[model samples]
Target: MRDLKPWLALIFKRPGRLVMGGALIMATLLSGIGLLAVSGWFITETALVGMLLAAGVAATINLYVPGGAIRFFAVSRTVFRYLERVYNHDTVLRLLTDIRVALFQSLASASRRHRRQLTGAEWLSRLTSDVDALDTLYLRLIAPTALAALVTALVVALTAALFDIKTATLVGLVLLVAFLIATIGTYLRTRHLAARQSDCQESLRTAVIEYIEGFAELTAAGRTGKHAAWLMRQAHQVTSEQAQADTLAGWHLAGSHLLINLSAVLTLWAGFALFRAGVVSGPVLVLLPIALLGLAEIYAMLPDAFGKLGATAASASRLNRDCQAEEPARDTGAQGLPANAALFATNLAVKHPGHAPLFTHFELEVNAGERVGILGYSGSGKSTLADVFSGLLPAAHGNLATRDLVYLTQKTVLFEDTLRANLLLGAPNASETELWRILEVVELADRFAPEPDQLDTWLGSSGSRLSGGEARRVALARVLLNPAPVVILDEPFTGLDAGTRARIAKRMDLLLEGKTVISLAHGPDALPGTDRVIHLPG
Candidate 1:
């Protein structure tokens, strides 16, 4: 539960909305109970008056006051209920927006390796399903439980005024016992099951995503049926857990219902005895039973609300574990890079967590306007070096400094947006003419020129609509648009054909003439012109 503090704080960050929502909920419940009690009294009084008139007994009874009171309660209940729903839901939506932004920022600030371990599907579940579960925490658990408490108090107070203190004490005791039984019993029975169900659901989500993403590979390997069977088995487990929770919830609801009805009956019987003894009025006797009925609106939600406790807690725990920010070690008192050098590094060391150092005591320097190639085979820390240079990964020990630079990774990642939108990421204020110039340098302008939207064409998720080579070019064009003085290309020409690679290389030389470039690749032929080649030690 301690893990939930941060998330809970976010929900209550704007206390005004929470308080207003709670006040409205209380008003809704009170109006509903008032309506039921007044209607019951009015009916009883009217019946007695009708009998008196039939018997030729003079009686004075005004229907206008009680009738008007009933109307006021009914209308207020409806109005307050509508207002409560609208305000609370609007507040919840705004709270969810804040939560999403906070979660994204936490992820962005997390260690690169940690972020890498979270697959795209896992992220989608956290951002959507986990966050959605939080809504139930406020609406179902907190609001309903708090309102139930308030309703119980009002019930006791009303009983005391209409009857004796002893009777009111008994009523309060009965309500408290019933509520505790319903809430605690439901929680103890369903908490583990709810947690298991949530886990199974996440597992099923991961399985379905894998099956879709790897459909071609699984089919080719003749393992698609096996994966599908596993997914079905997971679905069956989830359904089985859900059935157990539902069954337990049903039992709890039955028990609570019986207890409430018994309490109401006991109260009415005692009041009826008093009425027969000429100690209580007939209208007052009718009011006790109907008042308990009004309380049904509050206690009715207890079983389901407590049953959902486990699922909500599980989601909160998962989100807290994943989204908590970890501040990286800062390099204090480190000087800025000199204006004359593009990059400088000395006694550099880099390592992954719980692993031996990938590189140690590495040394490198590149003068301004120098095109350098870092040649290395796989597992030789080529990409790690790029990460270090781009400040994506911190150094274990080193003095490293560099001017602001744009990095193009080996994988070309593009969002599901327009071509123009994707390009704007590199240079937000770039003009159309500048965009066309960069595209021409990458040799993709002609391909897009014939299109209706030109640069406005929408690129599917990760640029799935484009061929591998075209995506690479689009990424390169984006890099070219960056205003940074230095650019790091990690295997920039990976997917291009030999002809296209040569053409892009020649064009890159012309376009990036005076900028410092660090091209990391397997061989020297990747970048056409290079001032020096530094081979990484394996």
Candidate 2:
């Protein structure tokens, strides 16, 4: 139980507005219930008037007034019903969005570390299904349930005042018992159902994402049957969970009907005896149980009453659990880039759960304006070293420092935007003079190739629309635009031909002047001017 106090506390932060909205909804529900009670009054009053001769026309006029009251209630309900839908839906979606944003922020720290442990399905569950399920909280559970119970209680009070005020008072006591039995019983029983439903959604998401992402590979390797069998298993598990929840819910539903039936019967027995005693008229007797019938219908929908509490609990649990990985920082919350930097790392080490140490007491230093080459066989800790140096790695034990560093991995990254957008990402407000100056250094001197506004041309997937060497150089150009004090490159020669490679090597010296540079190289022979070269033992 992580605790849901903070999340529930959000409900009261907008107290005046929430209460006002709730009050309006309550007013609407009461109007509808009042129409029911007033119609019952109309029936009873008309019946009683029929037995008297001289009272006929005057009684007809009296009945018509309550009918007019009933009509007014109907018109008001219809008017508010339209407004309620718009406002309620907006409130539900806003709540859902808030839940989603909170979950994202909570998971932000842990997600980067346990990427594999947090599956697509679990994410989808929280983002889509779990949060969506919370709509039941405000819509079905809180507003409608609160309104129904309150109005029904009022009707019960009205019934009691009818046939001897004392008898009506007893019915009020019975209404209390009826409400307690229905509301509390359903709450204690079905509250856990939301959390269980959230879990079910998570499981379904995982199975479905796994089934979809592996579809092509499974088809290629002819393993469709195996995947299908796994999906079937998950489906069965989901069904089993559903059946269990429904079984519990079935008990509550049965208990609700039983309580309502008992309340109605009790009201009848109590009210009927008074009718025969001349203590109450036939009209009062007939309407006493009808008012209880009106309340009985409302109490039967108790599941809708307490549903939001369960949803809030479920969402709060999901968010708190996901955010457990977020570590409170002891260091000041600043990641400033060092200028004119000399990189230093001494006794650096990092180990993973199932793997041996990537670096055990490793050490390296790069002097300003010096180019260092890192050559190693695959799996010899090349990219891992770059990650550690660039503040992206969590160290087991190590010291790593640089004032400012521009690091690029072997895998080229492109955004879905224009060429200028990707380049300006590092320094958003760079001038045209600064942009053109760096572009010429990378030997991409042309202002435009196919478009009049070359820099402004719409690029796809981190400039995948550019050729391989062009994309590499363009990515490099973006790094240049930042003008960081340190530049680190991992396998930048990949996907380039010999001419392109030579051109990049030529461009690197011109573009990376006065920067502390490190390159994880494929071959030492390719980068001749690299001042310090360290080769991993082959």
Candidate 3:
């Protein structure tokens, strides 16, 4: 339960809503109990009066008050139940919005290596399914459990006041035992199964996403059937785990029902014995049994709540771990970069985990308005050096300072949005004229010339609607739009044809004029207008 403290804090951010929702839930449940008790007493008392009347005895009975109370209880229960659903769902949705934003921000700030450890599918699971699981924490676990406790207390007090300490004690003990048994037993029985099911579900999601994204490659390789079979196997595993969890939950629910019914029967039998001995009244006897019966609704939901506890806790734990920020060593003496310098590094070291240092004792200095090209083999640390320059990766053992820089990686990424929106990511306030200038420079202006929507035309996922060369051009156009002092292009022409590459290189000098540019590629010839070239050892 303590694993939920962070999420609980989010809920409490809107205290008024939380309290109001809980209050409504309490009212709804209490109204249901009141309706049941009142109906039972009214029917019993009316029958007694009828019996006396049939024996030729005059019996006075007031049906107005009890009938009115029943009506009030019924109407209030229905109204409160509806209100609770509406208000609670709205609050949950707001909480989910906050949660998604926070989760994305946290991941965005994480180290590049750490972020890479979580695959696209895993991230989707965390953001969607895991967050959805936390949604049920408040309504299912907290509210129902709290309400059950309150109901138990009220029942015990009522019984003690109307009957005796013995009866109240009996009811309290029965309820306490039943609750512990249901909660503990269900948790123990389904905890492992629930965790397995969660893992299986995540695996299935990952497999499906992979199949969708790689369908073309699979078909081309004649392995589509193999991929389909793999997906089926993952699906079967998820289904099997789900079946086991459901079976356990069903058994626990059945057991909970049996216990509640047994408690009611015992209470009724004891009440009848006391009534015959003149220790209990008919109305009180009937009320006691019916009140216990009212609790059946509360206990009925316990099995599911406890059964899901394991999965919820696992999800919470995973989120907590992923959201945790790495404590980078603070360099107290670190100073800002000089105004005239684009970037400076001295004795810099960078390495991936469990691997030899990629760069050691690396020293670099780039003045303002310099065009530098880094030529290295495939396994060389050219891209990593670019990452260090852009502050995406930290150096292990040196002082590094750089002005803000725009980076264009080898893979061009574009969201499913209008061309205008994608460009706005670089310069939010840039005018349409500015957008056209950059697009024309990147050789993409003619691509949109035939479309009526022009800049407003939607770019499909990852710019799927565009050709590979066109997507790279759009990405470069976005980078060119950024108002940064330094520009880092890492293999920007990897997928383009030779003619397209030459054309883009010839235009690079004009587009990146008066900026400190560091272009990383396989050879110095890959980037034109290179004033100097540095080659790294393999």
Q: List the residue pairs that clash in candidate 1.
A: none
lDDT per residue as tens, model 2, 203-237: 76777887788899899999899879877887887
Predictions ranked by TM-score, top down?
A: 1, 3, 2
Against the correct fold, how does model 3 do in TM-score?
0.77
Q: Identify the superior model by TM-score, candidate 1 or candidate 2.
A: 1
For model 2, which pairs clash?
Answer: 121-205, 137-308, 141-304, 160-168, 337-403, 338-403, 338-404, 414-462, 415-462
Residue 161: error of model 2 in Å? 6.2
Kindly report which residue stretches of model 1 are placed more than 4 angstroms away from their true locations once superposed.
118-121, 211-233, 269-280, 327-344, 349-358, 365-381, 394-407, 417-460, 463-538
Write model 3 residue lDDT over 1-538, tens digit each, in one string: 6767888787668778778888999999999999999999999999989999999999978999999999999999999999999999988888788777777777766778777778888888888899999876778887788888888898889888887888788878878877876788899999888877877787789889989999999999999998899889888888887888888888877776677777788788888889999998788789888988888898888888888888887888888887766654323122656667788888889877677999999988888899888999998988887877776776777878777788998668898999999999889999999999888877788889788999998999999998887888888888889988789999888677778788878887887889999899997657757888988998
Clashes of each: 0, 9, 0
- Candidate 2 — what's its lDDT? 0.68
Local lDDT at 250 for model 1: 82
TM-scores for the candidates: 0.77, 0.70, 0.77
User: What are the lDDT figures for the candidates, one per model?
Assistant: 0.85, 0.68, 0.84
